[model samples]
Target: MRPEPGFLATYLEPAQAARAVAALRARGQRDVRVAAPAPFPELMAALRAPPSFVGWITFPGALLGLTGGLLLTILTSLTWAEVTGGKPVVSLPPFIVITFELTVLVGSLANLLALVIGARRGLRRGHFAQGGPFTRDRIGIFCAGVDPAVERLLRESGAEEVTRVP
Candidate 1:
């Protein structure tokens, strides 16, 4: 059946979803997303999503943590200027433990912040729900714009069910 103007989601088998995505791309349709019960290696290749930059987000945080950790250790060591049994002040070897701990603490906090931000962004872009089957056995192919060509392509590409979402 032809989907309504607000049409947004189509449910298909994994194979069908992959085919539909590939065909949609070939026809130059943008704004297509696939939701599957599990990761489909073939579908991922078809979607061609960009590699996640979450790791890059951690890099800056780790660098800041490293610098901050060393500074914190050095400053604390300098403040406690008690000469201990002919040992030099600002002892590097002893403070190594504190520096490492602080580095890990700061880096972990930063990483957690980045993860929360990423999760919020993802949740904001919610998918068109295709009921419960989608969560178990179905693959959902969601695309914006109610183009007739797109509808026809999806129908022809073997979607088991096609319905619109508000």
Candidate 2:
């Protein structure tokens, strides 16, 4: 079945947002998210999203690219040797430049691809609730896949404003 495509957003002051996030988590709501113009460490702690895999994927992809670049350099030099000043055909120093470039290229590409895939898996852009000027000046805590009872609980918990966008 397709996942629901809406979010419940509430605008609150930083401190209030933190509390709201904690309250949502305490109430067993796992799909909570927060957005703010500036950093909010407490809110981050409350959301507790699982670690991202971009780093892990990038490392191996970069290593493979480096290895491939080095192999290409070595094989090319050996297959088509051009003796200049009798220098060694397999020059590791020059290969370093190619390897480094390839590593960065592959790592960045892999990271971007992973981010796209990850975002598609329930990480689409979120919508905001209308809370007048408060939303621009305050933080927002949003919950996806909200149930009817959760809506009641949010209203009772001093949400100030709650909006569901589908």
Candidate 3:
């Protein structure tokens, strides 16, 4: 199994995949990539992935939107100074709608932007198959650099199939 520098190990079960990853890390193999059909929290924990920063981006974006909405409505009202029937010109009730709308708009946009950026960055990390069962019912573990020991470890950890990357 320790045949080349790059190899793909396919696993049919999530627990086996997680164990493989944990074993790789324990053996000091840092360049490990995993592909799965769905999000596996236990696998992620085994990989020791950091918490996502999308919420950090979203919070600032939402704050900016809220401030912008408030300022836009308040400033336009002040600039025009259009006093209607009995309501005050710079009213708070009417501005609520616009403020809420902008907050949601910017927050969601920021969240989308963060995910796109993260995905693109992740794509550069390792070799991935263009088409594979990993996208359906299997999990793939891609090791950027491998040795015979790594390959044996993968099979021992329950890799059903192992192949050279290219």
Candidate 4:
């Protein structure tokens, strides 16, 4: 058995890649892949991918942290029945620091985990992340199909070089 060839179009600037992505999408080529040294908001918009949902993870993590902190302080206070310095038991002031700390900690941890999973998932998709020109200078649009229309579209969109991969 033989592996199917791939097609790649390299761009000097992100705008060129964005143009290629939009053209590809217009042509119903949803498997287009983009690789660049840094993030490009224009390219992302051209891809028309959904907005990130990492914030959803962080919000729930923060809520859980807040609840855990409140439970820890309140339950412990209730269990011990400690009263000191004429201050009421289960006071809210001292719990604020721990609650805030846990909220920040859990929220950030969840955000970090989400980002890592998202990156890995992106790699599993059509995205290319090879080191070299792709990492330091150029952006590439890759697809598994070797259709000439895709190649022509890429070239018309200002690709610097279009090549076929084995």
* TM-score for each predicted model, relative to the true structure: 0.77, 0.74, 0.89, 0.89
Query: Model 1, 66: alpha-carbon shift in Å?
Result: 0.9
Greater TM-score among 2 and 4 belongs to 4
Error of 3 at 77 (Å): 0.9
lDDT of each: 0.73, 0.73, 0.86, 0.83
Q: Per-residue CA lDDT of candidate 2, range 1-166, in tens? A: 4445545656566777777778878988887777676677776776787887778878888898899889989999999999767789998998999989998998888888887877576345545434535336666666776577667766776677777756
Model 2 is weakest, by summed lDDT over 10 consecutive residues, at 126-135
Give residue 140's lDDT in candidate 1 (0 to 100): 78
Q: Give model 1's TM-score versus the native structure.
A: 0.77
Clashes of each: 0, 0, 2, 0
- Candidates sorted by lDDT, best first: 3, 4, 2, 1
Q: Which scores higher on lDDT, 2 or 3? A: 3
Q: Which stretches of candidate 1 lie over 4 Å from their true place?
A: 1-12, 130-133
Residue pairs in collision within model 3: 2-147, 2-148
Better of 1 and 2 by TM-score: 1
Looking at model 4, the pairs that clash are none
Total clashes in model 3, counting residue pairs 3 or more apart in sequence or in different chains? 2
RMSD of 2: 3.9
Report the lDDT of model 3 for residue 121: 78
TM-score ranking, best first? 3, 4, 1, 2
